[model samples]
Target: MRLTGLLGIEHPIIQGPFGGGLSSVALASAVSNAGGLGSFGAHVLHPTAITGLVRDLRAATTRPFAVNLWVPHAGEGDPIDPTPHIARLAPLYRRLGVEPPALPVAPDFTEQVDALLAAAPPVISFVMGVPPRWVLDSAHDKGITVIGTATTVDEAIALERAGVDAVVASGSDAGGHRGAFLRPVEQSLVGTFSLVPQVVDAVGSPVVAAGGIADRRGVRAALALGADGVQIGTGFLATRESNAGDVHKAMLHSDAAKVTVLTRLFSGRTARGIHNGLVRELAAHEDEVPPYPVQSGLMQPLRRAAAERGLADYVSLWAGQAAPLTASRSAKDYFKELVGT
Candidate 1:
């Protein structure tokens, strides 16, 4: 496959770069060493943590891997005071026996980029939008491959025009935040099968299909639809090597996984996850919540407390629509199952 050649990996499968600390060096290296392209999402990390994470990945495996960043780090637009949002979440924190959450400052995208370039991972994938021309030029000069995530064919065309080495056609069925940058995510809700061929026909770059893809059959379908590779998120999240909380991992394999919902309750951005209590409560008045990262920040205390205390009600159980189909327990085992090795 063209993606396998470009990424220099044996399998056309790519593990999703899960953010918010769900991604781990252990998980990424496991997949990469197994002959697939592993990835870690550095979007939720501080600049210094980003550097350390890349260094750790390099030390863990010699195989090619990717470190992902949100092109426009969350909370970049007109600043919204998170005071009211924090107030709203205060009760939740109190119930969880945690202190009120503090407002969050946006991570410096420039510093993170600089750190990423200095570390020089084989591939640097980004979502939300395309990187600037100068950024792409710098990555190319460093011999790093730039991959962009897109929700629509127009976004794919834009990435190709910007000179990305590859584009991930992220369908609405995927977990976490939608990568819609050109238009509202609702308008960009094309499925993996429909979006892949359209993107392949629209752009010259290789396409990696994401969303609603968990097992080998999904991988075969992606390739048959003209995608050069497949990126699996929810499937990898269930792996033992991943940093996902035990509760979150268990939810992926439970009957509850069959019913996933898209809600902005966790980060003020539409993301797919198991429909739990908090999601049910906040989803009704989602507009009252602050923007991305702000709402995310405001709820950090509750999420942390829930995770530490083994409470699943307040945690963000981020999973794709195909969570119920997740069939692997570890990254190494998953990669072998994916490749039929």
Candidate 2:
């Protein structure tokens, strides 16, 4: 089936689900109303909140939309003691006028999934890893189209074998977190041009190309490379409907986009963002940083403070390498521009 038939949308464009509350009902509904699949990144939300978010999205638009969640792992390794990292950031927290963190409780993935299943969004996408067999079965039973993110051909094959409806072949150039599950993220740093067709050739499922795609040219390139559709993140994040902070949005349009860097400073998982003071300061101390959510939790106060102060330094201005290509417009207008509508 063509992408339009697969997702029942007029265009093959999808707004990448931005996690950490950066996604909004307004943005999702805007994209959906404009004839594309909009999505909410529900990774950080609790079960009840997930239900409420779904209800909110449904109320906003009857158009087909998607919800995304991170497939929970016991993390990549054993949880490290977070005290040292918290202490290191204490000075920054004090400057921001917020207390430093104590230990943080990781969100319950099972409860989140159960909540999502109950809400029953039209499509559910997984990143970082694939969901369990029973969860996939449950989603299928509920008539949800399960899409999994892959950074390599092996990961794409794995998802197809797991019976997912589609696989997003996310190249390393993509913004936000690397969804490499089988190999180390550094080893899976394949460019979009190289990755998409390889994934398409290896899997029977439809392939959605993500990473460094911001304009019509990029979209056409992905489709030419055999991608059934395109998933865009930084492009949508720059839109007026997005919840990205003023500082983050400004950075995307500024010269800072020319020097995007991948570092674990923001969330302790490798993420691509514009280079700023915070990232530079913490770059040398990568080993000291705790795992994903722990480091993310520890830095929450700083991020919020940075946002309030309009300081881009501490905020995670997650963007792709092609961030400068993003346009500041409404999600609908941006969608139209991307598809040349």
Candidate 3:
């Protein structure tokens, strides 16, 4: 499929938008220059930083790209209360020479939204849920194509009704946060093979498939299964341009890659990643993970220490299920290999 005319791109490949210190200028530009849509996860960045990032990406590659963000959805879950989870990880933090932070982090999403307008990337993809109607309308008015993630046909139809340009069917095999807008993630784990066609059948818009797709064969399979485009994350994590830590890249090639488990320890939201020591422990005690931003906030100190000391367990190293077969290459080379398959 044409992937909605991505500025003369021949392949329907979109670099999966990764956030929480993964999206990088080099990675995005490389994909764009390679005749595929490069996407930057801008939800973690503020307006000025995002604008500068967009400008740098433009300088690096003349081709078009996208900026992605998470829609701020309302929830009844307590925003603050790391007491339950922090109590569990306090011993680990004390050992790391850092004090865990308090809960209920008010992430600066509004500033990020402002930044997206200034950067005005050709496309804006949202995860976590569909944005407010005004946000969608404003984005379209600015000529920004909107893509929203869904895990089921119900979610896909919701996105279509919300005026999204495309619906990304993020199956259960996908890494990172599971965008379950319709039901709890546990009950909505639809694999791409089963979810894509159903979503396409339910919606009039384009359907993008993600989760466990790491190569050209996966891309071809998605197309055969009724996907207009395929979004690959774990495959690109091993690429040279990716900002993932060295430990993360190494893990992609290790046997532990096959043992991925879904845990809510880091973000208090269900996400799958490599099963590390911390993952093993967390899996046994995941019920204590507070709530969204709270758990994410309390884990910052541990994650920062881990990053500084080359420790993998302290961070939420999100990766798809196809991690074991990962191959390292430049972003452009990675895309070539993908489209070639």
Candidate 4:
């Protein structure tokens, strides 16, 4: 089925889910109410929090909306020493007037899945990797649409085999974490323009083009490439209703938005954002950073402090290459502009 028909939305536009507290109920419900799928990235929330989040979205919009999760990769639970990683970031911690926090524990993915299933939202989306067969079957049993993200053609094929209702062809130009699971992220960095048509041809499931897409022009381009829909992040993120920090939003509307570089400094996973001092200084030592959740936890205190002080340097200013095309507006207005409603 086409994305719109399958998802029960009027337009084939999905508001890309934003993890790390960037997603907001206001932003999501606004887009959903405007005839598009709105998504909330719940990877960081506890299981109970996930339930509450769904309830909040439900209270706000009668339309369909999606709750997104990051499928845990292998070895994600393994213990690793954070000493070296902490030492490397000590300077930044001091500069931010904060101390390195204790090793943080990531929310259990299994528990999160259980909570989501119980909540039974209209749609569920996964990134990083595919969910187990039982989970997919259960979601379908409950009449929920399931979407999986892919950065490569092989991954798209994998998602189709996994029986996902749709696949988001997330290219390297996407902001936030790369969802490359079949191979290393470096090997999966295909551009959106190159990826969408290939994925559309590779999978029988509907294809949603993501990455570097912020306006109707990009939406037309994606459809031209045979995509069934478009998933937009940076564009919706710049809207006033989004939960992004003021400094981060300012950068999206500035000249700096024109240049984004992928780095693992913030979360120990490759994510694209406006090139800033923190990214530049740590460019050489990216390999030394600890794996995700740990690196992400380690940086949280500093990132929080930086945001409080309005310091964009230390905050994770995640944005895509199309960020320069973003404008400060309400998400509802932006949705209208996107589909010409």
Candidate 5:
């Protein structure tokens, strides 16, 4: 059976989970009501808040929705030391006339995961890396479907070995952070078209092709390449119901999306987003930016300030190559377009 048959959805479309306040209950429900799976990134929220959000999402619609989490590799070093990275970007903050915030205490991942699994959303998707064996088992025990993302075939194979129900072939062109599990972000760049087929063949499970896909053409292409479904992010960012700021939406209308590059300067892990001043400057001279959540911690102050000031250049305005094809409409409209295909 096709993967969508297992999902029990009318269409093979999924609104990929968005971090940084992009996903909303209204948007997720809208898509689910429209016959596609809608998803949200739950890792960014506090455990209590995420539980409430999941409750709210369930309230919005009985249709299926997905909650995403980032399961990090517990590295040897502590995730502190924002001082050195902060000093590097201090000048950028000075130019913007705002003070960079001192780092907060590191987040409690174990507590968050415990809450997430306890909430038991219908689907639990993971990015950056695969979950530990116990994490996957716990989700399965609750009858929650599991999805894993990878930038290369090896990672996809590993995820399949870990027993994910589905795999997302996250190509380099997909916006947000590169889902590199086996290699450094810089070394793991692979496009969606090439990566999807490889992963499909590498594993017995179905694949959901993500990255750079925006419109019907992308949908047709992914299906043609053996992907059972496609997960789209950047295309929805310009939608009216999206949580992105007005100024950020305007940036998407311009040529900014076409010039995007994968840069780790923003949050350490490489993400493809609208290329602007900070990206251009930081890409030149900088250390590897620590690791996933650590890099995200160091840049939080500047990103917050930039978002507040409506300064596009200083923020990591996450976008994908399909960004150029994004339409400024409600997500419902975009959902209609995808289903009509």
Candidate 6:
């Protein structure tokens, strides 16, 4: 297929990049060596850390791999008070025996882009929004393959216009933060089955289907829908090689995973995850939560403390709706099953 040729991999499977410390070099390299496109999410990392991450991944595997970033969207760097959001989570903080953290300073996007370009990885993928023209031009000059994420046909067209090498059709069923940018996330919640073909038809770039895909069946379905490849997240996140904590991985294997929900409580942005106490308690005030990075920063201390203590209730259990279908195994084995080889 075009995606396999474009990515120079034997299989057209891409391991969905996981941020917030869920991605690992071992996991990424394993998939790349196994002839699939492995990815590391470096959005939350500093510029130097991103360079180090690329170096580690290159050392682990000689095959092509991708580094994912979030193109800073609007309002991401705006000054906002976190006091009320902190007050809202006061109970959870007290329960976890952690204090509210100070406001967080997000890493500069321009600096990150420069660092990534200097590292010159084989492929670069973006979500949330498109990077500046200079960033794209620089990547092409370096012979780097650029991929963009889209939740709708219009978004896919936008990426194509921006000259991306490939476009990932990220459906609403996907886990982690929503990548919607052109419109409100609530209006962009299209299912994978419906979104993939439309995106494939709309964009000249190869289309990669994401969201609610775990096993061989999902892969085949995506291919039938004209997708050039498939990207699986929750499936890989549940694997032993992933950096997700034991509690988070265990929850994916349980019945709790079957009851996934889209909520903004975790990071002030809409995302799908296995429903738990935190989501239920804050369901009433989701609209009042501070925007991302702010809410995400305020909850960091509590999430960390809870995770250290093996408490899943307070930790963000990011997973797709296909969590129940996820099997715990090595990433290589999971990739083999996904490609049915």
- Which predicted model would earn the best lDDT? 4
Model 4 lDDT per residue over 149-266, tens place: 9999999999999999999999888888899999999999999999998998899989999999999899999999999999999999999999999999999989888889889889
Give all candidate RMSDs, comma-separated: 1.3, 1.3, 1.9, 0.8, 1.7, 0.8
What lDDT tens digits, residue by residue, belong to model 2 across residues 112-173?
A: 99999999999999998878999999999999888899999999999999989889999888
lDDT per residue (tens digit) for residues 156-205 in model 6:
99999999999999988899999999999999999999999999888888
Model 3 lDDT per residue over 111-209, tens place? 777778767877888998878787788888888888899988988998899899888899899888888877887889988889988987889888889
Candidates in descending lDDT order:
4, 6, 2, 1, 5, 3
* lDDT comparison, 5 vs 6, better candidate: 6
Error of 3 at 158 (Å): 0.6
Off by over 4 Å in 4: none
lDDT of 2 at 241: 93
Worst 10 residues of 6 by lDDT: 81-90
RMSD of 2: 1.3
Q: Which candidate do you rate higher for lDDT, 1 or 5?
A: 1
Clashes of each: 0, 0, 0, 0, 1, 0
Off by over 4 Å in 2: 75-80
Model 1, total clashes: 0
lDDT of 6 at 289: 91
Whole-model lDDT values for every prediction: 0.88, 0.89, 0.82, 0.93, 0.82, 0.92
Native-structure RMSD, model 6: 0.8
List model 5 lDDT by residue over 65-86, tens digit each: 8998877665723646667767
TM-score of each: 0.97, 0.97, 0.94, 0.99, 0.95, 0.99
